[model samples]
Target: MGTATKAILTVLLAFLIFGAAYASSGLSIKSELKAVTIKYSLEGTPYIDYVGLQLPEIEDQISGISQDTTKILLSRFYATGLLYNASKANENGYFTWSGELKMRVRVGQMTTDVNVPTTINLYGEYDADGFLRSGRGNLTTCIITISLYPPYTIGLSNPINYSFDLNSQTVNLGEITQLTGIVSLFATTTALIVALTKDKDLTLISET
Candidate 1:
């Protein structure tokens, strides 16, 4: 082979290898609601209907534990309700309205189901309107961070054990960054209450 031809082949081979490693450019995650349930307060013709996790920021903050650049998926926690308490239905029939959250990361490539934990729970609840309301949880995948300190380390971190209180606004939940992947699926309902609620109180509580 000619010298120029050999040189070109070498460059091409290098490019191919590099592409395979970072070809993903950025991270793209696909998800969908696995199990879903809905309950009415008054009777028929629902006034409020919602589902999915809550306090997205909290879950992001916890699961965001990374070593370097956070290109790796660690552990993840998911819940069926977030806007409020996720109570248990008087009965377990079957329902699937479905829900999910899509995210674009700066850079990452890895299988999420590897060497990590994924958790999902739904406590369910009854809203102030006498209807059920407990949609308790935060969502997302991912982390642990360490701080530099001496032996004088003070006892800190999520004070309780097991998990956060899934029934309250201050409840705990894996919690992510640059982080615009705030998934709040409880924003809409068959009654369109989310639109009005978002302006009056929902947004305010979420921001806090």
Candidate 2:
């Protein structure tokens, strides 16, 4: 093996078998998650309507799966804040209301409550006895659908419906049920799955 040291050990054994076949599979989501446009104000609320709902677990903003492989991944990040053009809610300046949309699923610790049927796309300004003196919303329900439930060996990256968009930047809204600004989350792809745990008493889901 002296032919230039056998071509440097055959290119270091093909870079360690292409880094272990790209860490054993696919998936490489990305997103520092940024998108701000928060400007809400409500004075003397007597219930003029102002509700929000968004489930953002995202497996910790995702990154090559961990946290026990997202419990078995076969998800449905539920989306319900209505505004995909419902006649723009009665074509006016802007006015729409109707809330409530919660999702909780954990089939290993007794916890499964999924309620879907929501609508709320607040506009802005409304005084003279109708709480919500000011309003502005943009962070509907987190929409996502994941799949990869087997003996652990995924290689997906063919449009699994992974969308990511939300980047405005205009913060100056005084909270309306804990608004921290920014939105939209993502989890990349292109070979990246370094989690190993098929079944050794697999049970890790109950983090609602």
Candidate 3:
């Protein structure tokens, strides 16, 4: 092979080996859900409340066996309305109420690292006085959905899905909280490694 051709081949081989090494490893999504918050309020019903908010899922960790391979990852938290029930109490009109919940998960590495925007899916019932029976009613529960590596990307075949219910009062909030913490922990650990490996021309996590 010509000198220039040989050089190109060598670089190509190095990249292939690097890519294989990186794919075998994985990144971690820390659980830092402590940043999420939920609040509610109501009108004349005195029994209802309004609540809404969206939280972002940050990085946790990136792992690699070789110095040339790194993985691009995306992740987020979400909530979906599974079911709800409400009843009327000492009032002339019946009351209708339903709830929704949030869940969290990480989207593994992708060929493209573009951030995916989060979406909220809502499905529930509202029962209040006729004055405002239907007017952008407050969301009793918010179903959160997120995608990774957007704009023409579909390899994993299945995106993460989380269903949450907040009306029961004994719902599984821990699952989401735990996942968030894990993602956060991973991000912090990876950051520390990067800070320490700065002296070397090599990156601690490879993006091969």
Candidate 4:
């Protein structure tokens, strides 16, 4: 083949390899509600008190490769019951609250609906003078399992997991820049090899 034709072919081959690597190195995510439990107790004489559970807003970050840009995946936070035991208080009694939080989880470019289970336990006490004695309030328990799906195999590495308290506002899993860089390097290397081979072939043909 002519020198120009050979150069064009080499460039095309490199781009094709790069495109394939880019497409195959995508990332995905999956999340599930593991468990939740809340317990509370009241001390001293019978008295009325209310308990409520509040979860922080959930968000995931999507970082851009070429540009300094970031995209946030905001989850629609919905809880089955936020307020519990409004009318009467369990006098010197312990209580346990459990329920589910429904949210839309986003993995890469795809989004899926998932239900996260939650539970909380608390204890409270009052003094003889009708004042608060010794007790714990605003207690919460939430366990969520986050699964990360990388385009490449993780091998022995464990998937990302997050555990948050009721007071927690945000939990950032991590970023996927390392994998993107690796794929880019592979594409560039493959393109260089193709160009080098073409150069060798052209030199041999001219000598013959």
**TM-score, one value per model:** 0.19, 0.25, 0.20, 0.26
Candidate lDDT scores, in order, read 0.30, 0.30, 0.30, 0.36
Winner on TM-score between 1 and 4 is 4
| Candidate 4 per-residue lDDT over residues 5-80, each given as its tens digit | 7778777766766664554444321221211222222222222222122222212211221211101100111232
> Which sections of candidate 1 miss by over 4 Å?
1-103, 107-117, 126-162, 168-208
Question: lDDT tens string, model 3, 101-169?
Answer: 222333554333332333333333323211111122233222233454455333222232222222312
Off by over 4 Å in 4: 9-175
Tell me the tens digit of each residue's lDDT in model 1 across 74-129: 11223323332235323222222233323222213322221222233434454432
Against the true structure, candidate 3 reaches a TM-score of 0.20
Better of 1 and 3 by TM-score: 3
Give me the candidate number with maximum lDDT: 4
Model 3 misplaced stretches (Cα beyond 4 Å): 1-47, 50-169, 202-208
Total residue pair clashes for candidate 3: 28
Clashes of each: 31, 7, 28, 14
For model 2, how does the per-residue alpha-carbon lDDT over 1-208 read when each residue is reduced to its tens digit?
A: 2346545655664565454444333222221222222222222212121122121333333222333212211122123322222233323245444443455544444454554333445454432222223444422233223334533332222221111111122222223111211111111111111111211123233322
Query: How would you order the candidates by TM-score, starting with the best?
Result: 4, 2, 3, 1
lDDT of 1 at 61: 41
